[model samples]
Target: MAKSKRNVVTHGLSGLIGDLLVFRQRAGKTIVANRPKPSVKPPTTAMLKVRGMFRKAVIYATNIIQDLTRKAEYEKAAKNGQSAFNVAFADYLKGPEIEEDLSFANYTGQTGQKLVASIIDNFRVASVNFSIRDAGGDLIESGEAEQSEDGLDWVYTTTVDNPSFAGGVVIVKAYDQPGNETLVQVMV
Candidate 1:
């Protein structure tokens, strides 16, 4: 009776019309138009593609920094070695002047061996000490070696090896071994 002046509309038409109406309300209460809830699921294939690009960029940046740091360390060591070499060469040109003091450092070695070194002059070597222990941190073996110049190229200050633990930690003491010393180069 109240709608006699207006055309009757279907429910579907009313819904369609309601969608177009902005800020609509019913009676005294607010009429919020129904909307599709946003998905809370994981990213879709398209989203993953975008994320993967960013991820790869991050990895590349990290590796670049790591490589640069390693190069810097090598360069510093080379500079030191070169200076020492120049001084030694000048002495050699003058012909063995009173056996000047010399030192070696950054020694690294494999398992099960004692350090051995024999040189004309008294000196000390820097060493890389490896300690393999049980869960309780009890030292299984300690290994060390000495390098002449760069830490990468070295001679086993200790000459002891076993077939059982060829690659494990070994402990050795620096001693004068009157014969050939095993030469070793640390791998990158």
Candidate 2:
């Protein structure tokens, strides 16, 4: 790949020149590269699935770009040389991620005990849900968590008191703006 800087012929030029080279603009700079060749072999099942997923991401990005408010939000989050559509498409392809394991050290089967979780997403995390289950797999409590002021952590206050929470399980599900969910389970 080569960068075209102030060249008379390639300056501000984009698209394919003949069948040999492809020119494009990025971050106010012109890029020159060889034309990519099409694959001759048939796509495998996994490749087809990935293609389908990318198609869905394209559709999602198109919808986001159509909405003025949502497009502005994504545009604000976009970095240099990145467009709103690019950020939205990448966010749709990737779900929310749990930054760390759930900490139950403060949760001692007492009412009003708080459980905190750290989560992150490419765009924005919409919500976090907390669920507790006993040793027998019976649900003890479930509710939505509140986002912290700094926007990095989610806090959930326990409502019910379960003295036998030692062998229980804590489940946390984090959701991104695109409704993609990431779940994590930890033994209490």
Candidate 3:
């Protein structure tokens, strides 16, 4: 048997070919063909409106929440920083504004100890003099020296011309030990 050629064509919107020979030759059997009916679809208006509204609401709410979070975080950080600075400043002020001197009289040893009484400046020393006199008013010990800012305290002078006080003053003349002392004299 010779194989037959099949042709399929359509004209206009709808057309049908009826030939038992085509069906038998192509599929080897009799077949019925039918066009599917059009399906009905729901309207998109309500669904689209609902989706758009929810999307806009979510976007707006997200932006508002983010802004609020950022502002709150900034406020918290500023409060923390301010508190820290306050604490630090309070600590800073707790110390003495001007450094002062500590003095002691009758410090032990043959050499008399000089206690600083005042400060001239932050670094410069003040011209100071000390004299030890006996009960007879005789100069038993004399010294001219520059002391640390606090006049009572004495530091070694860079100038070798620093005067020396007698190593020891006799107890009988001790009444004159610190008498007539010019503790500090600042040069203008």
Candidate 4:
């Protein structure tokens, strides 16, 4: 058995529509073509009109869906406990919105003990101030609280040695970066 030669053959088309083919073989190269064009109907004005109608329909559908979603969100906010249900851009720009959602959780302290409070903020809390008041509404001790490790809450800790923290009230004030403050009173 003998190994055949690895011959290279070329059968490529030329011109814009690839209608012409250049052939190569043992007889050399040749170029001859009488390609017949296929019949095709050119795009008409009706086709363009249909395409424009489809585009308009798509745009109208998208806009209606967006409007419905926006209205639903606005209504939900209004129904809920949103203080400023009016979605004015100017109101949002006016300083930081006040967050009365300050809450204390898992607080473990007593009178004459190390009064430690956990304060949570709905928004960005910048500072947490705590004050121990007497029964007569007099301020006995006031100081800023410390932030926790999780960066989510503020921790207020102080010694209840002033004797005002017994039957008195614990005032926790939370301030956000937007210059909004919230005060909460907790009974000792």
Q: What TM-score do all the candidates reach, one by one? A: 0.18, 0.84, 0.22, 0.39
TM-score of candidate 3 on Cα atoms, chains taken together: 0.22
lDDT of 3 by residue, 117-156 (tens): 3323211222444444433445544555445554434432
**Residue 1 C-alpha lDDT in model 1:** 15
Top candidate on TM-score is 2
lDDT of 2 by residue, 123-162 (tens): 9999999999999999999999999998899999999989
Taking the tens digit of each residue's C-alpha lDDT, what string does model 4 give over 2-75? 32344333233233435554332344433334555665978689988877755654554344335766435434
Error of 4 at 169 (Å): 0.5
Which pairs of residues have clashing backbones in candidate 2?
A: none
Q: Is candidate 1 or candidate 3 better by lDDT?
A: 1
The true-versus-predicted C-alpha distance at residue 75 of model 1, in Å, is 17
Count of clashing pairs, candidate 2: 0
**Model 3: per-residue Cα lDDT at residue 13:** 22
**What is each predicted model's overall lDDT from 0 to 1?**
0.35, 0.92, 0.34, 0.52
- Give the per-residue lDDT of model 1 (tens digit) for 28-105: 333335544567998999999867755654554344335666334323434444533232222222211111222223
Clashes of 4: 0
Can you tell me which runs of candidate 1 are displaced by over 4 Å? 1-126, 131-140, 150-152, 166-188
Give stretches of model 3 more than 4 Å off. 1-104, 107-109, 119-126, 149-152, 155-188
Instruction: Name the 10 consecutive residues with the lowest summed lDDT in model 4.
Output: 84-93
Residue 96 lDDT, candidate 3, scale 0-100: 17
